[model samples]
Target: MKVQLLVSKWCPVCPQAERIWTEAAQKVPMDLEVLDVAERNGREVVSRLRIKTVPAVVVDGTLKTVGVQPLGEVLKLLGA
Candidate 1:
């Protein structure tokens, strides 16, 4: 599965989200892309998904959840 983490450098909680997802990626067999909203690819995702917040999680091209998810929750989301 594909996991896209939509984040912004300015968002306070984004770093934590990134950490969780990065660790989760190491444990799962999925493609994990960390996208910054200020960048081109991230902007496209944000626009396409109508996402208005940072630390958003997208699984297999669908918006799964928003904000900073715990490690266990993230693993569950990834079906790990």
Candidate 2:
């Protein structure tokens, strides 16, 4: 599964989300992709993914997480 984390530069929520995804990544068979919204292809990814919030987590091309989340919380979302 492809797990993409879309976050903004200096976003308060990004760090927490990152930790959760990082932990979940270890437990799940997923390719993790972290994208900073301020970088190249950032806008396009958000647009194609229909992301309206930061710290967004997309799994298998579907938006599954938004905003900040705890590691345990994220795991439940990923069914890990």
Candidate 3:
């Protein structure tokens, strides 16, 4: 599975999301990608995904969840 953790440089919750997903990635077998919403590619992705918030998770090209999700929820989303 492929997981994209979308974050914004100024968002307070972004770090939390990153940390949570980073830890989860160690236990899961999926590929994880971290995107900064402030950048061009990240902006394009956010726009394409129709995401209005930071700390979003995209699973296999589909936006799955938004906000800072717990590690368990993230792992569950990845079917780990």
Candidate 4:
């Protein structure tokens, strides 16, 4: 599975989101990419998905959820 995490450096909760997903990725067999909203790739995703919040999770090109999800929830999302 392809997992894309949309985040920003200034977002306080983004780091937490990153940590959860990063740890999940290490345990699961999936592709994980962290994208900054200010970057071109992240902007494309935000525009396409109409995402209005930071710490968004895109699983296989589909917007799964937003905000800092719990580690268990993130693992579940990854189907781990």
lDDT for model 2, please. 0.83
- Across 1-80, the per-residue lDDT of candidate 3 in tens digits comes to 88888998899989989999999989988789999989887898899989999889888889999998788887777777
- By TM-score: ranked, best first: 1, 4, 3, 2
Clashes of 1: 0
**lDDT tens digits by residue: candidate 2, 1-80:** 88889988779878878887888899877899998888876677898987888988888888886888877887787777
Show the colliding residue pairs in model 1.
none
TM agreement with the true structure for every prediction: 0.96, 0.87, 0.93, 0.95
Candidates by lDDT, descending order: 4, 1, 3, 2
Candidate 4 lDDT, 10-58, residue by residue in tens: 9999998999888998889889999999999999999999999999999
How well does model 4 score by local distance difference test? Answer: 0.92
Candidate 3 similarity to native, TM-score: 0.93
lDDT scores in order? 0.92, 0.83, 0.88, 0.92
Q: CA shift at 79, candidate 2, in angstroms?
A: 1.7
lDDT of 1 by residue, 1-80 (tens): 99999999899999999999999988998899999999999999999999999899999999999999789988887777
Flag clash pairs in model 4: none
What is the overall TM-score of model 4 with all chains considered together?
0.95
